[model samples]
Target: MSTPQPPTHQQAAPAPNWQAAPGTSYVSPIPITRTHLGHALASEWTKIKSVRSTMWTLGVFLLLVVGVGLLVAVNTTTEDYTEVPYTIPAFFGLILGQICLITLGVLVVSSEYGTGMIRTTFTASPQRYRVLTAKLIIFFVVAFAVSAFAIGLVGLFTSSLHDGESGTPWGRSVLMGALYVSLLGVLALAVGSMLRHSAGAITTMLGVVLVPAILPAFLMLSDSMRTIGEKMMEYNAPNALARIFELDTDSGTGGSQLALLAGVTAAAIAGAYALLEKRDV
Candidate 1:
């Protein structure tokens, strides 16, 4: 029969400290606002733009594409072609441009791995697929910007030079060219990711992209070798891309051929992503 007395404020005891030591720093929690993917995209964009290779590759593609078109157009004379009034600047430069484009793609991913930055990239963006998509988005945008410049210049200059025959449709040609270049870069990105070594990726891509063209030339020296060379050139990426650019040409193949080539490259890219997931960071 008695009411409990109110406890005094001074009676409460202090809780024991659980931290390792007085001088030790506490681990910080991940921020709620952290946008790892956004950070990765921005960093990737900066890295892509900052590299000397990117600048050189873009500059060279611009010159080879626009400059060559201008040169060919200026050099065209009345005697050049009577049957075809307008000339599509010989696409020989595309051959070289592909190499540059592929290099740009390869460097996008391989350079990171080469410099031991892949670990950091993976750590920052653990969602591997998101990282791949981010790189693709950034690379494609850059490719489009540069491709527009090159293809637009080609169309503009070619229109000026030719007097008689109908010229290529600027809109279609430009769009196709941009898509082709962007896809080539994407293909290179896949190769780079799988190989993770610049030399190996570059060499392999060169073989996949260029050997087809060269084989036909080198093998032509011998009659028996001609068939071998011709077969190799049949499914080449450059040839398939050329089909996309000039729809009128026989293209030695059809839309399905292009789809097949793209499909193979896409499969390769998917395989690279799978490897990325399985392998150590």
Candidate 2:
């Protein structure tokens, strides 16, 4: 009668488990931890190693580097101490094997886009930039370590095989060259991220690495052009690596090429990061 007050039939909300997180207050049976870069790293590592492309590419690369390195060491019977460093043989294998590294680099990012897995990657980690950073870091570390190992093994073999011809700081030489190659791989990853297509990214990177070297060979028509060609030949990634290994005919360039490559790669990666933010999956 007092306006027929509705029955005070009320039920209290269930108490939340203090141990669980906000979103999982009722869903989770156990506690959950916030994700960090370490979690991203683990995810990236799992993705990288689980792919067949990684295994095949790295396997072929190892075969080329070690086999050719050992063969070169076994065949060099004379020591031209004044003309060559014994560690130079490693560069030959690296030159031929680098395509594999570039391929792996492109595949690392572009393959996700190619297969439409990038959506899941982004969905899992909404911070697109963080995912990219993780991929770049994982790719760079794997590349540098593998390249250093191959070069070091070859350098030691060459050092023992042609001890008299070896120059001082062979380890430094090996490491520098490995660093250059790894940088190139990172550049490839940037290209992959920007292009977002496996074949396209791989092809573009191949051109980046190979075209400057190849173009120089065709531009021998005039002195001015030939000079340009010579500069390109001297400054390309492969040539920079050769110089790092002390294989270049002239050491005039020092490490300026590597520094240049690094700068260019940084710019490319920055651009890629911006593009990732602007573009839709």
Candidate 3:
């Protein structure tokens, strides 16, 4: 009979309060801090160091720059350098080595796009410009440092081998040469950022670096184009590098070359920033 009478529904006890106690706040175990450029720089440094391409490209670069430079020095007599700076030998190697830097620069940005890692990168760092800036800074520093070291090493070797051959401005030439090559890498990075394709960006940069130099030769064949060809020879990357090392004395100062390249690089970087901001990951 008691079963027949449905048990009265007991009032459900009030759910226990799950909110934080009054005047108390839950603290996350993870530290919360606003990220800045330093964090971005660290991330970029880690990335640049960790990649296999970075190692391979830079290794080849050092090998070409130092190896060829030393080889050239070993083959030459002191008289060979009397008319040119001891550091001029480094120029021969750097002509080939610059390609490595350019390739590395393109890979710095475009590889991420090819591998779909750029999405993750953009997700983690929503401030795209900061990420680009970090890449630029890291790449430039590494490229410049390695370039300077290789060129400097070669210069030291040549100077020791041919001491007192001439009172060349080796120090200034080394600095300017390194700056020129590093700026080329920076420009490649800007192109990479804009193109977002490793092969295409790399190819485009190769054209940028090589085409002008080569086109001038063809243009020189034409009488009317000879002036334009001469202009190209003056401003092209190889000639600029040559001038920076004081190898081309007939031309004007290398300062103009640096300024021109700097302006072009600045413009490309501006374009890269604009596209990065406007485009989707």
Candidate 4:
């Protein structure tokens, strides 16, 4: 038999098959999009309001600002410009409230990291820019609102204390203060997002913002130190923030410096988002 012609060899393979398991069905993943910003904003707003710190900080911020204004108005030896010269009280109280805003900003980004919920956040909003943008929008809105309350309370209280004195230009002051507070919160959020370490971000912000202002005052050399202080004043945190006041305190030292700081801060926030987008959360 022709050696039984060598049989042509062919591979045997498992049959193609498909079946659904009992009580099981295919589920598709939800598509993420920019429109998801609304959901993100709602979620963030819920998270912010649910926190105890938010309540405490708002209360304390209002109390300190209003209390200090009352003190300054009541004790003023001369009602120089009426309005009880609440600048000292308002300014210092604002500085204190800023620390709280920093903490709030940190929580905006870090709380998710702390709880391992950032993964979910990223999942729900895979387009990282949307998530960050949503966060910033929410922060700006919330910060502006809270700052208004604090500033308003101070103005109201100060106005009450000054019976014979004219009202301060608080309407403008409050508006400007609100803007400053919003910017400060944004700065904190950007730094916190970039660093991802609560302690490190907070410490760095405080050190950079507060320590430099103090250093200028301590130097022994008067003229040179004054020059250094003046130059450094151009970089000081308060000046950058003081822009909201709108009162022309000094040209080079206050608004100009803060305007520069705001510009730099906006750039930093953008850079931070870029890094956050490129890195693993």
Candidate 5:
């Protein structure tokens, strides 16, 4: 009884409340928001603008498109524009400038693969198609805008120099030509995505554009291939641009050329999407 009662254990102090007060939920200091295509577009825009290759390629493109166009315009007279739109001179420059765009397009996707940055890109976004869509949209917009500006500037300069040449409408032809070139860049982009190599994709696109123009000449040597050669010339990129610029009326209508390019580009894009989805980084 009285002598040896065990010392009672001291009650443990209540644990401190580390969470937010009652009825109030803890909020993280960092803000969280859902990502979307707009975010991907912004990211792509930043990447494209910050890269040295973008500046270099685009600078050369402008020089070729505008410089050569102005030079051609200066050398020609009003008579030279009589049978073609004022924009036709721009077509000659674009024939070279388009290579710049194709190169840029290939670099856009392939450079990331080369640097192993695509894994980070996919990790950040998780949706491959969204990233591809952003690339296509940004590249197409930039390519089309730059192309149109250069071509249009040359057209206006030529028109002003000539003063009153009767030819096909400059506005429509200039826009169509710009669109066609942009599509070529897009096709190049798809090829880059598929090949995952800048040099290879660029070479492939160069062949796609230039080979059709040149191979048809060789093909014409054989009677069996003469008709095929004519068709190739009619549907080739150079001839398409020529038709659009009214420089070549025998190569088929500009609309048909655009349709052919559009269909081919669509197929290429589909293939790119499939490969991207199925392949591992």
Candidate 6:
């Protein structure tokens, strides 16, 4: 009974999720570092390379390009190229291969939304704009590289096989062909961001890239619309790419088409950025 026992009290431990500061959430296990666009770029590169969709789409694209290109090369006569130029054969393959790039581009953004992985991506990197920018850069670079490779292969094979087929405009064909594909990819990414649904985005991009090719054919005697339709065909991706190859048109003025595509892509991206900022993940 001697000494009076003091009342004992248990104190509660600080919870992990307790807000330490205004607007500050719980700390993540990832090391705190100054984050930048480079980090987001690396993340985007990893995602694009690791996905099977990228592999399958790009693989089929290469297969179509190489296979059709080689066949065209073997069949082409020196006379056939004298008037048409050597790199024209690549147009046949690239016309189809472009669809693959467009599909892959849509998948890059839309697939994430479809699978709900975009939530995780946004969570890890809170800067939404950076993530979208990273994706656009990574996708455009990859698309350009792959398309250039295919176009380069076709151009080289056509040149070598024909022997002394000078004045082929190799520079314009390879460079512009790659640019055309990359531009289309960027557009598709923008559309994907806008739509956020895989099928809808894919369908919309398909119309953008493909419908123009056929629209001119179907437009009959609408006077004002006929002129617009002809312009659509003139500026359509396939025709523009063909112009790069110096086929179907002697001007080979792909520069104009490239400029137009660049303008459209820039506008679409601006719209996408606006939408991204105003919307929730």
User: lDDT (CA) for every model shown?
Assistant: 0.72, 0.84, 0.91, 0.70, 0.90, 0.86
Give the residue spans of candidate 4 off by over 4 A.
1-35, 82-88, 164-168, 218-226, 239-254
Off by over 4 Å in 5: 1-29
The segments of candidate 3 whose C-alpha lies over 4 angstroms from its true place after superposition are 1-29
Q: Is candidate 5 or candidate 6 better by lDDT?
A: 5
Among the numbered candidates, top lDDT falls to: 3
Give the alpha carbon lDDT tens digit for every residue of 43-123 in model 2: 999999999999999899889888898887887765554455566677778888889988999999999998899999899
Q: Estimate each model's TM-score.
A: 0.77, 0.87, 0.88, 0.77, 0.88, 0.87
Kindly give the stretch of ten consecutive residues in candidate 6 with the minimal lDDT sum.
15-24
Compared with the true structure, what per-residue lDDT tens digits does model 4 show for residues 1-281? 45677788999987545444446684334332345668878877887788887777667766666666566556653354443234434765786777777777877887777778889988877878878887888887988898877777766665565553554555666766767767777888898888888888888778867886787776535875787776666566676545445334555324555476678679878888888878897
- Alpha carbon RMSD to native, model 2: 5.0
lDDT per residue (tens digit) for residues 1-281 in model 3:
35577678899998654555345696444555677899989999999999999999999999999999999888888877766788888999999999999999999999999999999988888999999999999999999999999999999998898765565768888888889889999999999999999989999999999999989999999999999998998899888888888777788649999999999999999999999999887
lDDT at 134, model 1: 82
For residues 1-281, write the lDDT of model 6, one tens digit per residue. Answer: 69988999989886655333335685664455678999999999999999999999999999998789989889977777765556677789988998898899899999999889999999989999999999999999999999989888887888888765655557677888889988898899999999999889889988998888888887736776888888898899988987878776665568888899999999999999999989887
**Candidate 1: where are CA atoms >4 Å away?**
1-30, 34-36, 77-87, 163-168, 216-231, 245-248, 252-254
RMSD of each: 7.4, 5.0, 5.6, 9.3, 6.1, 4.2
For candidate 1, what is the total of clashing residue pairs?
Answer: 1
Query: How many backbone collisions does model 4 have?
Result: 1
Per-residue accuracy of model 5 over 92-208 as CA lDDT, tens digit each: 888999999999999999999999999999999999999999999999999999999999999988888877565667898878989999999999999999999998999999999
Residue pairs clashing, model 1: 85-165
lDDT for position 208 in model 2: 92
Candidate that beats the other on lDDT, 3 or 5, i.e. the better one = 3
For model 4 the local lDDT of residue 155 reads 62
lDDT of 3: 0.91
lDDT (Cα, 0-100) at 154 in candidate 2 = 81
